[model samples]
Target: MIDGLKRPACALPVLLVGLAAVGTAWADGIPWADRLHAFGKASKLVCFLPLFVHFQNSSRTRLVFAAYLLSNLLLLLLSFVVFCSPDISILIGAKSPGVPLKNYLDQTQGFAFIAVICVALAIEAIRHQQRGQAIAFAAIAVAFFANLAFVNIARTAFIYLPVMLALVTIRSVRGWPSLAVLVAVCVLVVGAWGVSPNLQFKMARLLGEVDAYETNTMVIGGLETGGAERLEFWRKSVGAIRSAPIVGHGTGSTKELFANEAAGQTGIRAKIVDNPHNQTLAVAIQWGAIGCIVLYAMWGAHLLLFTEGLSRRKGSLLAWIGLLAVAQNIVSSLLNSHLFDFYQGWLYVIAVAIVGGQLQRRRDTDQS
Candidate 1:
């Protein structure tokens, strides 16, 4: 409230998050730092809530959105150069091959959002008969998709991309047009799969990793693949949640719980991870069912804010942007706890607050 977040829908989540933090501080075991860690990450929404008022200025909001696109474009250019020329990549001090900057996960996620933005903007350009702008935006969208297919890939992007495309298509078109566009998107995905060995390997490896984790036979040189590690985390998380389902083991308890489980184990099972890699289970382990309710309620409230009473009309682009961001976070959260991570958590909070503020402005204008 002090931060100027007026809507109860918005404020409730912040309030619950604060309460969760307090509860964590009170929870026994684990150091104070560990106790506050998860909630501290969540408190960013509250910390940034004050900026919501500023985004009500449509011009400023547009500027922020433009900066996001330009920055991502720059990252894409550098990534392509690094991916194509290893010598240049090394000269530039790029740490990982093909990924010139952040890990594959963050890059793919950001690029997926860029693809959504380009497609939405391209549709708007076409509607206005701006053929040049439409083509440029569409080409950029395809370029980002190409990076995911041929260059470094994150399996999470494959999840975010289709959900985002379907949402954009359904919101932008109706009836047969929607179906046709969706069909085209599917065909493009299929074509990418057929062409990109990287894509095929990732897909096939996903199944193999899961099978290996289940069979307990995939360890090599005392290391596990990301997929296998995630499976192991999820399984252990479920057991921990069952140990204290209602109120959870309290804040900052996940590591200790995991440590106990991992005790006397070897290989991947011996790995004690603070994060379970799934957002819902992450909360459920810390705060149990009550925490989970608040988490889902917060997500549902934001989704309603962006989706309900919004349509493909003039000035609806802000709503579409907000909806796509929410969708991307939700879909990706299934595999990784984006809200717990610094970069992605802030990205989600900032996108939602800015767009939410602008949408509220539009609603106030219509009412007046």
Candidate 2:
């Protein structure tokens, strides 16, 4: 394990995180109070320390797996219920009708993953001739997909879900069967778009927002839409990165960067933001080109590791789960800084650590 830490890919994320803390503490211009606040948040990285341990016991691993899956299923059911009933939604005080916990983006991302997992599990159950279990899993997957299509879903979910579906189809079937599944997925998407006004509205809004941003007509009815503001933030963040393409402004410097950029500006251009909403830009703002390299290297390493883990027959489901998490993070990070977000970050960490540990244990046993 210690030897593994010496590997560049394995070591860089940890090293960069430490650097982030130090950079935060020593960042100039930012008040000591603000710097200390950032440092404290950085120090909370210890919360994930327990992930270093492997769940070597099969029973315990099964329990953890069941808990994870069931919790997601529960969330799916609750969200669906709320989506269908405005009164219950209001009673629960859900800011978003379907999302009882967390915001829409996080919940939708989670559901997308769960939908994929349920599909994979269903395939496995069918392969094993467990018809009842297969039926249940497939039904749950349908519910998840329906919620994503008819209820509130993050815009990023539309981008990644198709990729995930393609991966799953390729993994589970091949040749004509694979082609058929892909076609079916496309038809389902088109059908949902036609039948679900919610999907149509969201898609239309996304297109309008992009057009508005490009045309510099962001303010409609005297208020700025979030989509245009996000685009403006990305534009400014790119300029900031170009200004300091090497070491960056320092950790916790994004707020200050945006503050400076917003100075003497007007409208959306004047809006100050802490998160540029893009993960690469977010990291590059703090650590620059080096940070981007380390960030991508870590993603590439985990992705490759999980891809290899798929060849291990004993626990390939875990590998699939890990792969989905990593791939989702990579795709979604293009639009949102999910890696820095508490729930999404922990999800990524837990999926990688648990699956990687199991694969390592299996490799050791095979070697012996």
Candidate 3:
């Protein structure tokens, strides 16, 4: 039933389009609609808070975990359908990709959450020697890579997923040649790239990105894209940060600071940046030097707890899944606003907190 509801290409595509229009405010200004939208998205993370809390009854915790898993599973299926059915995606407000498979993710940034899920799940499946499960999870992940309208998604598919498979799959296959698994993973990833136009398009954009940014070149063919925009944003953001090195502009004020910097200015710096697009810079911008220290300390704590969490069980599966899930947030934050993002931030915290909570359980278990 949930999966059916998730489908953008439902029997009632008209209703789906109507809902999309409402979400977009019909491109018309509506009082407090934006706030309502924000609240709804926020609730996705907020609703899972109790899952982070200690549950004396094991059943409740299991149920909550299952619910979260099912929701993402349905979403994966929905994304697959949207990818194959271009018309449905178009109705749901995907402005780019021409075919517009951007149905539920809103932004390509949401793919990070999906990646964490896929990687963690695949690790678990591999640990258990579940070939069918591993294959299904991998295929779904590949489908996501092909259809999601982001260059980074393709990069993620090629780099992180295969490397993860190479390392993590080694744990399960003791008798077979380890290199075989790595070779197969590489072949499959490259084959996915061969079939996926999305990956090809992103690669083409990257080639001219430098020239586009340097010369204000819009169109040489592929969407007038460039890596220079991020580099430039970083350069200007760093320069502005030097003025207030100790304490930042304050939380949630990143865009405001950028606007202030860009006021009456021209060129790329003239445009407001949503966040520093770098988590380290984002924290520094929000809380300055103190924030960075806090972030590092928090990571240490999370790592320790995740380790302890894995110590709860005998198998190495927990360690592999926990680390893979947590690492996505940290790595993505380096270049994009993953950790600090409202949607992504909640996800990062919740995943770590769950691991932390499990670790705590093990401590209690060991003590008692």
Candidate 4:
């Protein structure tokens, strides 16, 4: 309430989050499915949805968002700069027994989250023309880049880059020149991405096992031995969606359904990995087409708001940043489990809420 974000339409986000909370709460016959990670996510969204509207002014909205943004950046800065993770005990020299030290910050999903935020900040800096901020963000960008390419070597990390570039293009002035410059920058990104050691390893393994599959082979062989198992999971998920195309199999049923479908399939790891690692398919498997629609509806609403802000062109730079953040998550979901991923989902909700809040504020400004 302190920041001056006032809009009755703000109820939309809260309503959707609440609906999601109810859906997860009552979706499964099993107990505590709602209370588990998904419900925990819903609860957090319910709590956070109002904060955006609470901040009424652009300056204050930016301040609140910046505080959280800085913390994410700082966590990334520390994660790479230090040899050991923060708040962990040393195992050898300073052996404290119970508190063992680990280099990984497990709360944040590796490198994907931090990289997009850094990219968003960099864009913000350039748009606003804060030279010092731009230079500092550029420095920090390396840490994110290194973490993505070297330490994490995540595919989603690679996917997020293009999504961000697309988002920036939304507000491009001198459009052709910006497009040309972006194309040149992409050349360097692709070069670095190609050379990443982890990527080379994954590509090699995937190619080695490709011959095992037939003309229409969803069943990839040598899964337990080590190969691209994600394809199988994705295929099975698609099959499951076909089974219950409209309503879906229901929430929290991905593992059960996937395991059943892939059962006795040759060379596959006969396991019920809780998540299929693909957000859309996972939803399609669990909730079917209807569930998929609702899931997308949540984002569709947010996109409308973000685009609204961009069109308004008043204090909408944040909207551009928010759009990029949401876009990164959407793309990440296509390649990773992101629907209820605690950390990433929160970021998504927060971005949408802030942008929506700004739109509400902007509406008032326009009305006056």
Candidate 5:
């Protein structure tokens, strides 16, 4: 029994290192990018097996895992049914409504699967009486997957799996040398980010475009800003919020409000801006200050809990990974629309639970 436990424990770090190395290679632009991408996609099935085995050993962890899995399965079935249904156009009163429910169905399927896996892993760590480990798992999973889902599913999964492996490596070894290597890799990654022209250009363009629109709001200039249509919608949204400061006009009111606000303005008309590009601003407009405050409080509570867990296990590699994951998710939330999506929200909740569970475990251990 001792030998069996020791072997898997010893093997874990080596496997993680191998995973990290593969990830770093991809980041640096490995040869045969297409083949690498395909291989990575194929590997997910294999990767999930070990994860399943790890969680299945514990009853509580397994139950949580089953719940998450069942939810995803249900979501998948719902999506599949929606996709197969014929597109129907229904007339409600005077307006003709063309609803593409299929689009929504197709989009959320991957997110559901990803969320289930991450939540399960986090819960597993909690059951094992590894509070820091659980938090670290959830944080890393949320941060990494959030970004990946923001960009591309396959690419994100490819990069994330390796980083996770590296983290697991640091957990098993509990050595300074292993940690030093991880630190060195991180520095290299940051340095690469500084030098990559494509990354720099995209970041600058996104920030600059948003800034220019905000600046133009002060001017008494002509109504047309050519390609800055999104800005115009944003301006209209601000006016709507100002008009109803205490409570929002209503949920899904932005489009209507934008139309009414821009009614008299030349060249600026209400377009289908389903969501504001910025989530915080969107929530503020839809739900008013009260809604924003409630959302912020929830966010703050989760962060506080995760931070407290970190303090208890300052040396945990998993904790560091979790910190990075949380940071990634916060940043991604600013640019993406996943916070309100059911699967995504549940994933975030699980992440918080995972970290919280880890903290509870540590407290119990300390008391004993």
Candidate 6:
């Protein structure tokens, strides 16, 4: 019974991590959320020290560790190139001062730090031969919630790594029941305060206005202007794509095209929108359908890696978390441009490493 009780403790950290991701608006005034985020950041930094010590003692899967490092380095390099190159603007023919290379590098370095911590925890789990299935599932759950449209999708991937670890440590069904109760209580509390009601009303009103504007043949006076503006922009974007069905006008050219097209439309004079509200359309405009296909393939590869773990039931926890994270990213991608976020990129690498480590462990066990 004590052991069963202990299982829920593992779930606590994960639950906290998920809440931290989903409830950031609430955290504006809440001391616990602020402290949790601060603590999570600090813990990620210190996590590597004990992990390195454990690895030295256990002498397990050093090659996998090396591969993880290499993947992180590649991500860091990609972030650097994207943010640093002044010439990149020239290549893409886009306008706007490029992001400072140093800042970009520093941002990704933080992710690298978090990745180290996650890898360390994954190694610890392997050493103890703990249940990996639960951890993976918990990670997925956190990722799914974190990737909600309003949340910072880029941060969802890395922020939930610790949650996955916590899930693996849980040993009881009681933990699930407790989590359900907590979620219910949070929903009721938020609902009573008008948060849920206000959010729902606002989202519904916005969508309704957009739909009404689309369907109306006659112009309605004093109709909210923003919805009409977005529709106009979306239409212009579709026209641009039709004109250049093969290669796009060029990378970064969509904004200028959008602005030009919108300028011609009556009652809409907004400056060129920087991004299409839709991520798929934005990518299609920049990279063309081929680029979009390649992007999808890359995401599919990550999903494949996580699914492979599930098939073997070797690292079920890591696999579930990874699948959730990847799924959230894929879904969120419909609305947000997460491909460029430093945090999510590193999280992807760490997740893959966790899966790889599990596969390696299984292979080793089979050999023995």
In the range 1-368, model 6's lDDT, one tens digit per residue, is 22211322222223323332343332233345343433343123122223322332343554655575566445444434543565874575533222223332233333423342453355456557765943653353333232222211122233343343334333212457757744664574356335433335435555665655566322344444444555665677788778766545544455567666656544454446655655566656544565466456656655675676666655664466556556544654444444333354445444444444455456557668
Q: Listing every candidate in turn, what is its Cα RMSD in Å to the true structure after a full C-alpha superposition?
A: 2.1, 2.4, 10.8, 5.7, 18.6, 18.1
Off by over 4 Å in 5: 1-230, 262-269, 314-325, 361-368
Residue-by-residue lDDT tens digits, candidate 2, 147-214: 88888888888788888888889889999989998999899799889999879977777777777776
The residue-by-residue lDDT of candidate 5 on 250-273, one tens digit each, is 455555555556555543353445
Model 2: which residue pairs collide? Answer: none
Task: Please provide TM-scores, in order, for all candidate models, with all chains considered together.
Answer: 0.93, 0.92, 0.70, 0.75, 0.44, 0.45
Cα deviation in Å at residue 137, candidate 2?
A: 1.0
Q: Which of 1 and 3 is ahead in lDDT?
A: 1
What tens digits encode model 4's per-residue C-alpha lDDT throughout 99-153?
1222232223434555555665676788789888877776766766665555444
- Among these predictions, the greatest lDDT belongs to 1
lDDT of each: 0.81, 0.77, 0.53, 0.59, 0.45, 0.45
Model 1 residue 280 lDDT? Answer: 93
Question: Which lDDT tens digits does candidate 1 get at residues 163-262?
Answer: 8888889878999989998999789789889999889988887777877776665464443577888988899999988988988887777888889998
Compare candidates 2 and 6 on TM-score and give the better one: 2
Q: What is the lDDT of residue 272 in candidate 3?
A: 71
Clash pairs, model 4 backbone: 3-55, 3-56, 4-55, 4-56, 5-55, 5-56, 248-287, 248-288
Of 2 and 4, the candidate ranking higher by lDDT: 2
